[model samples]
Target: MSVPSKPWDSELVAKWLEGRIEAAARDQATADRRGYGAEDDYDKAAAEEWVCRSLRTTARESEQAAFALRIKQLLDQEDYRITGIHDDRRVERHVRATLRKIAKMTKANEGFENKLRYQ
Candidate 1:
């Protein structure tokens, strides 16, 4: 997977996640209003599931965004040298490998986000 050319808008994501949580809470309250019955039980369970999924997604995205920002800052330094490592080439390779891993994870997260949208 390739890293997205566009930067992640952390603020935008935060706002979106907030909206999702609020919506989920509203749905859960509606479900609760239906009273304790089979259909109500199902509705409550579904609402809980949606909330859990959203929270999980929010956590992952927040962590990834923070990691990406830190990596970008690290790369911006003029003389970023790892302790006890003199070979710049080795450091470069390690950074590149780490970046690739992050890209792969981000791609997977996008897929999950899409799945949630459709669900």
Candidate 2:
């Protein structure tokens, strides 16, 4: 079974859930002619599920980046690596990854979600 999260993060989780719901609505609408009545509530349920999944995924990724930055900084400070390592391709990949990380999975808190921003 999944473990519980802290109460302090409830708002953030709620926002995530809203986004998921919106996305699910769009998806379901596209998938079938008939839907489970109560379109609004169905969207809300999708959002809640999304929020739970998102918090776990994003937080874990952020932690990894934080760890990598710390490691790189420490290594640089040590003046080690006489030979070439972490080449341009490797560095570029991480840079792109870091940029993507900053984009966020949703803008649900702004009262929009599931759909791309400005949708």
Candidate 3:
């Protein structure tokens, strides 16, 4: 999938992450319930916890994406100026670095989702 050209909202990203996490947890809980051949609260809770633990990497990526987006937005703002950066080159460098970070996060997330899909 192609990354959106428009800027991403941090809140939206957070909500998306929460939804993904919840869905994964629910799927894990259901699978655990099926394997046990019965619905057990404790087992479901344990399965959810395990799923959350396994999704730490995904959560981290979401956080990085949000951070990168925020940095990009700040840099793009006309009024926001870096005190130390007197030259346009330095400012451009910062913007480029943030963009790279966003791109890296996007690629990593896509690869991770693809791995999950094949699994």
TM-score of each: 0.39, 0.25, 0.33
Report the C-alpha displacement of residue 37, candidate 3, in angstroms: 11
Best by lDDT: 1
Where model 3 places Cα greater than 4 Å from the true spot, the runs are: 1-4, 36-119
How should the candidates be ordered by lDDT, best one leading? Answer: 1, 3, 2
* lDDT tens per residue, model 3, 15-78: 4444545664565456555665433432333332333333344445556455545445544655
Best by TM-score: 1
Q: After superposition on all CA atoms, what RMSD does each candidate show versus the true structure?
A: 16.3, 15.7, 16.8
Of the two candidates 2 and 3, the one with more favorable lDDT, higher being better, is 3
lDDT of 1 at 115: 22
For candidate 1, write residues 1-72 as lDDT tens digits.
Answer: 355655555444444445545554565556567655434433433433333343344444665555445445
Against the unseen true structure, what C-alpha lDDT does each candidate score? 0.45, 0.37, 0.43
Clashing pairs in 3: none
